[model samples]
Target: MKIVTKRDRVSLRRRVDQGTEEQRAIVQSILDDVKANGDKAVLAYTEKFDAVQLEDYKVTKEEMEDAFASVDGEFVEILEEAAANIRSFHQKQSSQSWFDTSEDGTVLGQKITPLEAAGVYVPGGTAAYPSSVFMNVIPAQVAGVERVVMVTPPGKDGKVPDGVLLAAHILGVADVYKVGGAQAIAALAYGTETVPAVDKITGPGNVFVALAKREVFGDVDIDMIAGPSEIAVLADDTAKAHEVAADLLSQAEHDARSSSVLVTTSQALAENVQTEVEDQLKSLPREDIARRSVEDYGMIIVCDTWEEAIETVNEIAPEHLEVITADPIQELGKIKHAGAIFLGPYSSEPVGDYFAGPNHVLPTNGTARFSSPLNVDDFVKKSSVISYSAQALQKNVDKIARFARLEGLEAHARAVETRKERWK
Candidate 1:
């Protein structure tokens, strides 16, 4: 990990927004092809990029049953428990339609409507992330969306992972597809012959997938333009160096661009953590990827005071923040920006990633400054409900006309004026 003082903050911010124009162009081409050719283009790209060819792109019922039987009974029980926790947490986020009525005959309210359909993208290749299946699906289901579609890349043999398939079956997601990358995103945005168009798309993906989502934002609602995984640890002299090092590396191992940072009041603890991270990285299986991440993006910023450390954390607005101080709870109040916060030594970031009810899909980079995590609200739209009775319209007629005409909107003014005339 690179050790530095708080003065390097400006340069670090620039480094986080780095981009590649060539990658964007490639993703655009794939998106264009999918939009024009539909399922034919999707299959061609799947064969070209994933090295798998397929006639039919949808997962069959037999495949879902096979996935269930392949996994052990113990694993199924654990996933069911996790699903229950996720569902319960999201259910609390569900809201009801409300109306406010007045004796004067004005009815003002909000009506919440779940999206008609939603598409979830799951990255599939060598590794399988069944947890993602649970995290993305349950919230949409809780929001009362009717059709939840899933799209994942197929392996060399052209089959989705057992765990991914099992997770879908457990959630009762019937519409699963065998295509991925930019093509899948395009298919979801605009209807393909096989994959139906969706109102929204949510999940983390590679750079190509991110670019595809960015290109199709207006065509369909999306969660966020996700960046690399990142975690920031705020600690003081009282915090243990080994635990701090472990937490930093947990995010670093995700990818070479993933950022892991430590801001501390004590120079001694910073030095100890730097050494501990190096020691731990030597044994990790993804050492090459983690090492590059640590060398390039990992940082340990030593500050002169707790106030300075907290200020630095807010500037970064990291995706995940962990506070390991003598009073972690007290430190949380001082933090104003972060996607998800893990307080104290026992409340590590992984707790929120897996078992905890909070959604794992969060704003990345510095987007936590303005955005939020994926929840039930992401799957629903709210409409304002307003009805004016004759008495109400008669009372407010002149004011409505004056306001609308003042803005040069004669049509708007006439609509209210005509109703008011009938009332009078």
Candidate 2:
């Protein structure tokens, strides 16, 4: 990681968007094919990309049972514990339908209802993250979604990883499918023969998968167009150099473009961290990916004071922000933009990523400035409920008509007038 001053913060903040025009075109073609051809197209793409041919796309109950049985009992217990923590944290976010009434007999309310079905995408290939499965599916389930359909790419032998399947089984998600990539997203957007259409799609994926989510957005609701992983460590002289280095490398190993930055008040600490990151990188199993990410995108900005460092963090709006200052709690209010904030040295990024109660499905590419982490709210919809009695209409119809006329919406004005006459 390169050490620099606060002056370079602006130039270093901009990250290249991963999906290109070519990727968008390819994802669009896949989406169109799935929309037109349905199951046949999904199967063809699954075979072509995943190198697997599947006669049955959906995982059967027997297969799920087998997956559960295959997992070690100890790991299954750990997953259950993690699921409980996640469920407990999100249950607090649940919303209830509420109504209000006025003296003139006007009733207004918001009816909160969970979507009937939701689709969750889990990437396949080298790694299988049961934590991600728990993070995405549990929130939807807690929101009262009737069905949570999960789609993942199958291996060359046409099988989903046992760990992924076990996590689904633990969550009671029975409608898991053996398909992935842009094709799976398309299937969810427009219902295939076997896969049912969903109310929304939520999960992380590669560039093609991200582009596919972008293409099918209107057809189905998506959580967000996920970018590469990123983390920012806002530390002072009091923070440990080794601990800070480890936290930065955690996100760095995620992807080549994944950014790991440090904004500190002490130049001495910054120099120490820069050397520590390189020393730790030599032993990492994913050294090549982490090295590329740290060398290209990683940075250390030495600020004059803590205020400047905090300001820089808000400007960048990283997905994960760790504040390891003297009193981390004092800096909490100053952190205006971050998908998730980890405080103190013990609160590392992985805690939230796996065992912690928070959802790991967060906004990226500086979207934390506006967007939020995936929660129960993402799986539900709200409708404004309104009702007016004759007394209410008599009191307000003329004012409503006048406002409608101002907008040149004659039909709207007449609608109010007609109601007012009836009230009279």
Residue runs of model 2 more than 4 Å from their true location after superposition: 16-18
lDDT of residue 237 for candidate 1: 87
Candidate 1 displacement at residue 145 in angstroms: 0.6
Alpha-carbon lDDT, every model: 0.91, 0.91
Off by over 4 Å in 1: 8-10, 13-21
RMSD of each: 1.6, 1.2
lDDT of 2 by residue, 156-267 (tens): 8888899999999989998999999999999988999999999899999887888888878887899998888999999999998999999999999998889999999899
How far off is residue 397 in model 1, in Å? 1.0
Range of the 10 consecutive residues with the lowest summed lDDT in candidate 2: 8-17
